[model samples]
Target: MIFFLIFCVTSGFSTLLNQDTLDVIYRYVQKTPFKKIFERSGSEASFINEAIPTAYDSRAVYPNCKSLTSVLDQKKCGSCWAFATTGSAADALCINGIANVIPSPQRQICCDNKCLEIPLKQCDYGCNGGVLTAASLYIENNGIVSDECIPYEENSSKPCFTSCSKEGVKMEVYKGLYAKIPSIMKVSENEMKKGIMIGGSIAVAMNVFQSFTLYKGGVYNRTDGDFLGNHAVRLVGWNDTAEVPYWIMINSWGTEWGMNGTCYYLKGKNLGNIESQTVYFSTTPPTYHGRQVSVSFSLIFIFLLVSFTAVLYLLSYVCGRINEGEKKRDLQEKEARTQMLREIGERRYKRGLKNRSSSSVRRRRLSSSENEDEKDTSTRMIDDSEEEEESEKDIEKVGLLS
Candidate 1:
C-alpha cells in the first residue's frame, strides 16, 4: 500500500484503476500522525457551547427531515445499497410515523438476492461489493425485515431463497431543502438551530477535481484524484457568527476519513471546493441547537489527553526510580552474598591449604565482584543526574519583575 500510494503521488493518480481519489486519501492518511484529529478540528463554539463540549458525531441526525434513526453499516461488504436503502427506509418510516429501529440487510440478500440470474461467486457479498440502490429498491418492493425472522446474515456464502420475500410497502419521499447563498457563514444560528432536530439528509454540489485526495490534512489548493463521492447532505443548521458562518455537513465515511466524521464548509469556499472535499451528510436541527448545552466539552477532552500523558510521564519517573532503587538493593545483596562466599572459600582454602593456581576461578569471581561495585556506582550517578534534570523541568523559570 505504501509503495502504491507513493506511486500515485508521483503519477498524480492511483493504481486502484479508477479509484484515483483513494490516492489523495492515501496521501493524507500517510501524513496523519493522529487518527482522531478531526474530532477537535471544528471552529471554537460560541461562548455558551464553548463552556461545554458535544460528543455526538454531529452527522447522526437530520434537520427537520424526519430522522430514520436506523442502523448504519460501515462497509463490511461492498453492499452499500443495503446501508443506503436501510437508511432511506428509516427516513421514510419516520415520515410514516414508524419508530426508530435497526433494519436487516440479511432479508434483502437472503430472500430476494436480486435476480440471482448468475450462480453465486465465492466472493459474493463478502466485502467484495454490491449495489446500494438495488438494496433500497428491493426493500421498497419486498418490504422490510424482522430481526427474529431475518437478522443480519452479512457476508453469507449461501444465497437466499427466492420465495422468502416480504410484501412491498409504500413509502413517502420528502425532497431535501437547498438554497444558493453568497456564503454559508451568512446563515444565522437561530435559522440553523432548528434544522438539526427536524431530521433529514442533505446533498452538496461542488466541482470535484483530482486533488480532492489531499483533503486529508494540512491545506490544499487542488487534489490529484477523480471525484468519486457525493456532495449532498442534511442541513442541520448554521453557526450565527458573522465572522465565520459555517454549516456542518456529515459524510458517509468514518471519522478517520474526513472532518472528524463531519465537514464544515468554509464561508467563501463551500461551493466548487472539490479540492476541499465538500461532501453531503445529515442531522436534526433542534438536536443541533441542544448540542450547545455541552459546547465547552471539548476542553474536557483536551484536559483528559493532557492528564493521561502527564500520568504516563509520572509513572515512568516513579517506575524508573523504583527500578534503580531495586537495582541498588540487589547490588548490595549480591555484594553481601559474594563476600560471604569469599569468606567461606578463604576459610576452606586455609583449612585445606589449596594452592593459588587451583583456586583461580574463585579469584576471578572475587575480582568480577569488585568491578561490579564500580559499575554500580557509575550507574547510580547517571540516574541521579537524570533525576536532577527532570526536577529542573518541574520548576518554573522565574523572571525579575521590575
Candidate 2:
C-alpha cells in the first residue's frame, strides 16, 4: 500500500509538469504568425551561380571588424528587431572598408516609427515588439546613426531625437547616407549560406523555445520544450560539416547567455524558420573631398555672407536714425537758447527804462521841495522887516511927544 501511494504521487506530479509545459508551448505557437513564414521571394536565383562553402564564419573572415564578434544585450525590452537589423548593417559596413562603427540600435528603435505604414505581418512598436523587414527598410532609406551618436536605452519610453547626442561628434559626420539593401528576401537554407558568404552578416528570425533560453553551449538542436515567441538575430556563418549541421547565430541576450551570446541552429531543416527571411545591406564610404564638400561649403559661405550683410544694413539704418535725432535735438536746443537770450535782453531794457523814470521823478520831487523852502524863508524875512519899520516909527513919535 505504501509503494502504491508513492507511485500515485509521482504520477500526479509528472502530469502537472507536463500540463504546464503544454500551456507554455500553446501560448508561443498561438503568438506566432505561421502564414508569414511560408511567404517566399524568388531573389534566391541571383545567388544560385555563386560557390557555396562547407563551413564559413564572418568573424574568421573579417577579423578586424569587432562588431561581427561583439555580442550586445537587448535587456528586458523586446527590441531584438532593432539590434539584429543594426548589427547586420554594421557588420556589412565594416566589411566594406567603413571601419569601426557600430550602428545605433536605439536610433532604429525610437526613430523608425513608420513601420506600421509598410504592410507587414507585425509593426515595430519599439520595445513592445516589431517586424524585422520594417527595420531593414528604415536603415536602407534613412541610414542609421553610429552607436556613439545614441546609445541603446532598455527603457521602452526612450524618445527619438534623430540627431547625434554624443559630444564632439557632428550628426553630419557620423550619420551617413546611401545605405542600400538591394532586396529583402526569404530564401532556402543553401541560399542563406550563399548570402552570408557574399554579404557580411544577414538578419534572420527564429522561434525561441523555453529550452533555448537555458542553453549554455553545444550545437543546439532541442525542439522539446516550451515554445517561446519569435526572435530576431544575426546569422554570421554556418558549418555543414558538423554532426547535426548547424547555422551560427549571434544573439542579443548578452555574453552571459549561450556560448558568449552565440548559438547554433540546425541548418538544413530551418528548425526555427531562420532561413525563411533574411536581409543584408551595402554602402559606399562617404568622401569628404570632391563636389559634395564644395557644394556644402558654398552654401555655408553664402548663408554667412547674407547674414553679415543683413546685420550691417540694420546697424547703418539705426545709426542714421540716431544721428538725425541728435541733430534735430541740437537745433531745438539752440533755438530755445536764442529765444531765452532775446527775452533776457528785453527784460534788461524794460528794467533800465523803469530805473530812469524813477530817477527823473526823484529829481523833480527834490527840486519842488527846495523851491517851497526858499519861498517860506523869504516870506518870514519880509514880515520881520515890516515890523521893525513900524517899531522905529512909533519910537520916533514917542520921543517927539516927550
Candidate 3:
C-alpha cells in the first residue's frame, strides 16, 4: 500500500484526473487573479541588475534561521496569503530575537476581509483567496494580535471580533509588532536570496500544478504538468549543494504533505514564476502581553496541585499512625485480661486441692471412733448370754431333788 501510494504520487497520477478533480485536490493554494497581478510591479533594476550568485547559500550563514520558520495548514480554507504573510513576519520576529510572539494569520486574513467588505466563503471567498500585499497593508495599519490571543480555526463564517487592541477589552495586544511591506520588487534568483538574508523569509507566489501537490523531495521543476493556479508561499532559504539546486519554499498545506512542510523548487529555473513575484518586508520587534500571564497561571496551578497532594499525604500518614497506636493498645489490653484470668484459675485450683485433703482426714477419724463402739457392744452381749445359761442349769438340778 505504501509503495502504491508512492508510485501514485511520484508518477503524476493526479495529472490523469479531470480538471475539476484536480481543483478539488489542489484547492488549498489560492493565488490572486491574473487581473490583480499588475497591482504589484517592481522596477527593472531589482531584477535585471542583480547577478544570480553561482555558489552562494544563505542557510550556511543563518543556520538558526530555520528555527524561525513556521509551517501552516490552510485546511479547507484558501488562506495561503494570510499564512504566507504571517509566516514571513514570524520568521522576521524570530530572526530579530523575539521568538515568543507569533503573529496570528487568521487575524490578518479576517481583518483584511473586513477591510475589503468581502463576505467570507468556505471555498474561495474572503479567506479562501486573498492577496498577500493587501494583507500586509492591513497588518501595517491595524496590527494583529498574537496567535494565542486569536487562534486560527479555518472557519470563514465565524465572526471577526475587534481585536483587543481595537476593542480595548484588555491590554493584551501590542500594536507595535506589525510588519510592513514598503516595497515589492520582481527579483531574480540572487535578488531573492539577498532578500532572504536581509529579511528572514519573503512571501512569493508560484504557479501550482497537480503534480506539485505530490512533491516529496529533491529540486522540483515542472517540465510537464497541468497548471492549476498561482499559490503563495514564504521562501526561507535555498541549497545549491543538493542533487539539484532547489529553493526551500514553505507551503500552507501541512507538514505531512511536503518535506517537513517545505518544498524544494528547482533554483534559477523560473519554474512557476517563483522568482518573479518575490517581495521583502521590514518587521517590528514582537511583543507578547498574554504569554506572561499564561506562564504565571500555569506555575500557580502546578504549585497548588503539589501543595494539595502534599497535604493529603501528610493526613494519610497521621491517620495511619493513629490507627497503629489503637491497634497496639487493643492487643496489650487483650494480653492483660488473659493473664488475670489465668492467675484467678490457678488460685481456685489450689483451694480445691487443699479442701479435698482436709475432708479426707476428718472422714478417717470418724470411722475409727465408730469401730471402737461396735467392739464394746459385741463383748457385752457375749457375757449376758453366758449368765442366762448358768441360771437355767441350777433350776433343773433343784427340781430333780424334790
- State which candidate has the highest TM-score: 2
Ranking by TM-score: 2, 3, 1
Residue 69 C-alpha lDDT in model 1: 29
lDDT of 1: 0.41
Residues 226-294, candidate 2: write the lDDT tens digits.
Answer: 888989999899998888899899999999999999988877776777767676654532232121233
For residues 1-402, write the lDDT of model 3, one tens digit per residue: 644544444346333433222221111112323213123224322443566455543445555654344566888777887878777766655565655365676676555653321111212245568765556545544555677677778866665656543343342443333333322334566657766765577888777888888888766777467888878998878878777888877788888987988878888778877776655544422121111223332344355555776798799999999999999999999999999999999989898888888888778877877777777777777776776677667677778888
C-alpha lDDT score of every prediction, in listed order: 0.41, 0.69, 0.60
Q: How many backbone clashes does candidate 1 have?
A: 57
Any runs in candidate 3 off by more than 4 Å, and if so which? Answer: 1-67, 114-125, 164-185, 283-402
Candidate 2, residue 170: how far the Cα is off, in Å? 2.6
Model 2 misplacement above 4 A: 1-47, 116-121, 172-186, 283-402
Candidate 1 TM-score to native? 0.31
Ranking by lDDT: 2, 3, 1
Question: Where does candidate 1 stray beyond 4 Å?
Answer: 1-73, 109-133, 146-157, 161-199, 202-260, 264-402
Query: Model 1 over residues 1-402: C-alpha lDDT tens digits?
Result: 644543344344212212212212222222244324322222222322532222122234332332332223344444444444444444444433453444455654554454321111211242344433233324433455443334454554656634333345333222221111112223333223322322232223344455542356422334346755433233333443535545554434445644554455443443454223211212211121212312222333345555776798799999999999999999999999999999999998886765565578788888899899889999999888888777665453332322
Decide which is better by TM-score, 2 or 3.
2
